[model samples]
Target: MTSTDKYIEMKVPAFILTGLLCGLLLQPVAAQTGPAHNRPNIILIMSDDMGYSDLGCYGSEISTPNLDSLAMTGLRYTRFHNMGHCCPSRAALMTGLYPHQTGLGWMTGTNFHLPGFTDELNEHCVTIAEVLKTAGYATLMAGKWHLSHNIHAGGPQHDWPLQRGFEKFYGILTGAGNYYDPASLCRDNTLITPLNDPEYHPQHFYFTNAITDNAVRFMQERPKDKPFFMYVAYTTAHWPMQAPEEAIEKYKGKYDAGWDVLRRQRFEREKALGVIDKDATLSPSDTHPWAEEKDKAAMARRMETYAAMITIMDQGIGKIVDELKKEGIFDNTVIVFLQDNGGNAEGTGFGGPEGETRPVVPKNAAALKPLGKDEVQYAINPPVTRDGKRVMQGKNVMAGPADTYLAYLKPWGNLSNTPFRKYKNFVYEGGVATPLIIHWPDGIKAERGAVRTQSGHEIDLMPTIAQLAGAKYPSVYKGNEITPVSGISLIPTFEDKPLPPERAIYWSHQANRAMLMGKWKIVSGGILNGPYGKWKTYVSLPWQLYDMENDRSEMRDLSAEHPDIVKKMAAMWDKWAHSTNVYPMPWKEVKPPLRPDYMSTPWEYPDF
Candidate 1:
């Protein structure tokens, strides 16, 4: 374990402690398994549908002082990759394996029933919670737990957080939804609507605050003798952009300058902050000019809502930090913050308010009856509000209200992922790249605010936590043969030792592929279909290569000049795809299991 694990270790010898003292120390100490070891408490916080440069530390104009403070004294990683989307990213992060190995190559909603595409987390893989809990860490999870396929109340709960090793769980079963009256919202194993949840009744029921509050409650009531591990997954800044009106008002007129100017501004700030290469050129964008926009006011208002969502999350992070400090565990707690994926460019309610399921409502409808305390909210996108207001969306309908549902759209997403090329679900830097900030004052051997240029991936998290807790990763768990971890511990980086080069990093989501080997990177995203004939698939696309040392933004394609290198990397990617159960993708043969339809259309950029 790094320098921080000593905080919670109870190593008082029986011979040394007198009669009554022995009982007091050993009573709870016996709860933990394994040898006496220093195990730092870990808090993993993840934001949904955010961008690489969205944090103030990462050069955004948004107010994120809490996250900025963490970055100020923490170690920042410049070349970390997340899986292009939430499902696979979370899978890789939790299991220390590629997504396909966890039977989550696709999303939880899709049950291809194939090797790589099972509906829920498979038996072969163990979660970070399961591993840490075995070593006596009290595991608590707050926020989205979208790893299970059967989210319906009466459906099977075999794969929910409680079964997966979390001692306490308070969050949604499905992914993104309304913050005020979220669907699939639950406490522990029982599903309940926010309006009637008996245990928690804040002045106002906001999801972000609720998530952090429950986490704080867990910490407060936790057995102080044992170390703890928490996963705080916040669904902020995702589609159906909603926040407290006052929070949204904080960023009013923030984006009146539009995406082009905003993107450029963030680029300059990132360079100045040393997060990006000072000499790196900002990647170009396809956003409309601010002056010529027909709905400049609406776009600005939408961005304000998005910024507010992030700002609120930042404030929640501050609350989490404050609690840690109050509990006197701040120095020994490892606080990690990263986004699930880059900014989403889905065309959610982009055009009009006519998109609601119940398009028309009585102008002044009677108030809807409140559900029973134990009744569950089943729909992620409900037809009406808890009080009978019809849920509406569009350019005319303002965002940041309970009755409104919409995303900020692509132009703002372009600004969110400034100096990088695409949005979520693609393998380009903009799609998969996210800022990773880690704070462990007692354990970090590197200088404060140090930036590491070495490349890392979500898979690295599992092994890193394993080393921190000194927990042994199982070879065979519950009779199922477990897959070996594909990641190495990241602790070495925190201790000032640079990671050796030459390990290949692989990624494939919806046929968008990338492989990074040393300074060279090969990516192919032109087609959703894997390369046909040669890659043994029905689709084809040429591989584009880049020298990452120079073109971190992926602006320069060196494929034609380095065909040999491209061919070699493509061959490696093909072999990996086959071995990792990425072959026989369900898209070609198996019909996709009915998945919840959430967005209108995915934002597709030019294919040049």
Candidate 2:
């Protein structure tokens, strides 16, 4: 009132002066300060369908220098876990919630009208990007965006990357496709033609390269005023194993000894590297022996191609790391590299559908051309045309060419998981365990080249990023009440501090179930076929107990000896499944929406 009186005396308009004073008083606190220095940029890189021991640092023969370098400078978590499959692991990683809580208990293709089977990120959850963006971070995503079901549909996709709070997005919207011409390639919210389109001469288009290029571009173009969050989800080393001929050539004759020898070699190396305990016994091979293989040359070639795919991915990572260095942000950037799940065992050993009797084309065939250059199509499962015509998709073609679509299959997949008992889609250590490497030059002051033996899961990533970025998880977001994040932050482990002893991690995929309470774990699923395959029915499978502290490879099943422990763990898992929207397993037939006709265009059906 005194100030207003003074202003009136000075012949100034009281209302105008008061307005000016109020504006000065209400100036934002951020306006008076400099940018936040403690907030670090986050780069979360994930490899699709990669095994736990595929990287060189993790005891693989694969040339992954970039990832290995990252491991040397950063901290490696020896006991990190995935959700035993791609979609669920991804959903868990992005939302900091159980996959079921994020509405992806099943894959993206199916929407069974169940709480956890919606095939899209639910309204109750918030992605890392969404949460970080609210804290003034520029969120970007590159590579696969398999969180939504209708990615191939026309119009602005409601659950696309941009809509999920990514400031910029460049990647395939579907789960998988050809590396040369990926399906549903998009920039931001708009679908675009592949970079190697006919207009571009001498096309050098590759999925991994394209993903890395866009990631670097985002870093270069981002606002300097804000820290950033980037999710670089690479689809390399997944399926349709294709790589540059030169890269494949580099691994020639490397796997000639076959999986029997290779698995043992890798297990020994893992022990030497301290990635796995020396006492950890290698599991007996459920796959056929190397001596029993008829096409040793072709099998070796497939492994070579698989190695090439990983090497190329590593090269792309190198490029991105260089860009980070050039941007002067490498020191503060938090780089987390991990795989989505264990290796796949989907195809036959001879470069086609499992149990196919078709003859495979030799690599020397003049008509075969070079692998990874031509467009190869193949039928994988229930191999047939839409109108019930038998199609020759996987017949008589060598893998590693664009004209050939083949997975490395069970033999290689068994090798890839190394010492573990099963491949992807199971609850065993082979399926769920993954290597997690975190590098933060400024934040992590612990010993370099050190390993953290604590058990962590993909769900821990979002909470870890939130803690590192000083971002708060909102209780309510955009008018919807959000679910609490189900992950515990791994910040304490970065400083070599011990994690809490009582933390429990749970996993459920396609009826395969597991629970880890302390060092005790109870698992209930394995391979889906053959004598060793214990996976039969979803609901009635016997729960097997493992003292994880002693048996990391899951060679022994202690369910009978520890019935009380198994009972307790099973009850706990049931409680988690019920509370987390994981019930009503979508094992029944669910007719999904008609996928658009993209085969004429570059898109192809995923080999899930």
Model 1: lDDT of residue 602:
48
* Candidate 2: residue 553 Cα off by (Å): 1.0
lDDT score of residue 73 within candidate 1:
95
Q: How many backbone collisions does model 2 have?
A: 6
Predicted candidate 2 versus true structure: per-residue lDDT over 341-390, tens digit per residue: 89888764343435454433433243333223332222222232222232
TM-scores for all candidates: the values are: 0.88, 0.83
Instruction: Name the lDDT value of residue 335 in candidate 1.
Output: 95
The candidate that achieves the highest TM-score relative to the unseen native structure: 1
Where does model 2 exceed 4 Å of error? Answer: 1-35, 153-156, 195-202, 348-396, 526-539, 588-608
